[model samples]
Target: MNRISMVAVLIAGVMPFTVGCATKKYTREQAAPIINKTNELDDLTAKNSRDIKDTDRRAQSGIADAQAKATTADQHAVQAGQQADAANKNATQVNGQVASLAGTVENLDNYKPVAESSVHFGFDKADLTKKAKDALDQLGGQFSSTKHFIIEVEGSTDSTGDADYNYQLSKRRADAVIQYLADKYQIPAHKIYLIGLGKDKPVEKNATSEGRAKNRRVDVRLMTNTGDQQQNASANTPQGGK
Candidate 1:
């Protein structure tokens, strides 16, 4: 009775423990595939997030490249517009010069020379020398009795600088002469015809210093359409001072 009773008690206790272990093992096996599936899903989500970030970076880079290209195109357009404007301005200047030449040719015979003078200047200088001023004074004296007269002032320059710079220099020389005449004789603006020839019409070759000095000069010719005015001006024509 004692052995049988002990054996039955031990069997009952062992049966419950074995059943509990089997249930625990079956639960673990069933949850294992779900855990692996969850792990796989987590890995896919992380890869998708990385791919989305990389795509966004590439899209931002592409947009930046497009913006850079657009900025470069805008700069090129601005440069092209500036160049076109410069070309148009040059064309307009040329047309005005042609019209001026035509007018001069048409009115050539309407005037006759009454008095003439020439004044020289220093290198790159527009200020009048004492001798040059004295020479101009002689020409200015003739304007008192002259009527309906025009003073032709042709300024020149030596070939020593840029063509555009020389043109401006010659114009400054001409302005100096005009100022003296206008101030001293009260000459009207309409009675003066001015031209800046620059180095295009040098009186002497520019190869020598003396020749260049001679080229830096302004030529003045007092002219009138009226015969009586011309005769009157001839009496006061400048002599050796010119």
Candidate 2:
């Protein structure tokens, strides 16, 4: 119960409190790293999740773009196929017409020139003038009394332009003439053998305007079998010694 005993008791009591604080500090120190590590792991997991979401979004966008492009390409391919099919169908039709015409050209007899003509056109013209129509009408009238005649048509062009262009132009001009004759006189399409000679057979020089004009012409001739010609000639002969 003296000063030393009292001091000893006080020290004993303070020792227990200090020991408890030390133990608590040690436990906190030990758990502090674990808590800090757990927080760090959570932050890392969240960042990884965000990264994964961003990657997924980008992947989806890329896939969508690719799908759109693929669809567009497929559409283009379909259109190309349709165009090719149309072209093939047109080619088949043209081939059939040509074949039919070929069969009509095999007659062995009665192929002589009955009438001839030169249909002229102005610069870059595929249309017939009034004078050209009149000439065609006269030819048609003359042929009204003839029998089994086939018209041979040769389309020509001047040498003033590109050869291929001139060839097509000459063909158009010939087509114009043929169409006119067919529509006006009811001539059959098979009675015509037409060609576009272009600048290959020029009637005159293309250097001059007048010469070019002369070159822009279609030479047409009518031909008939020998039997028909003779019959017509005999019919036309005057009756003698009757």
* Best-performing candidate as measured by lDDT: 1
What candidate 2 gets wrong by more than 4 Å, as runs, is: 108-117, 121-151, 155-216, 221-242
Reference-based TM-score of each model = 0.51, 0.55
lDDT per residue as tens, model 1, 115-227: 99999999999999999999999998989888767799999999998999999999999999999999988986656889999999988899999999999999999987789
Q: Per-residue error at 232 for model 2, in Å?
A: 15
Compared with the true structure, what per-residue lDDT tens digits does model 2 show for residues 1-242? 99999999999989989999999999999999999999999999999999999999999999999999999999999999999999999889878877756755776254778777788998888898888777777777867876767788889988877889999999998898899889988887767888999989998888899999999998878777856658889999999995
Q: Report the number of the highest-TM-score candidate.
A: 2
Clashing residue pairs found in predicted model 2: 110-225, 110-226
Predictions: Cα RMSD each: 11.5, 8.6
lDDT for each candidate structure: 0.91, 0.86
CA displacement after TM-score superposition, residue 150 of candidate 1 (Å): 0.3
Clashing pairs in 1: none
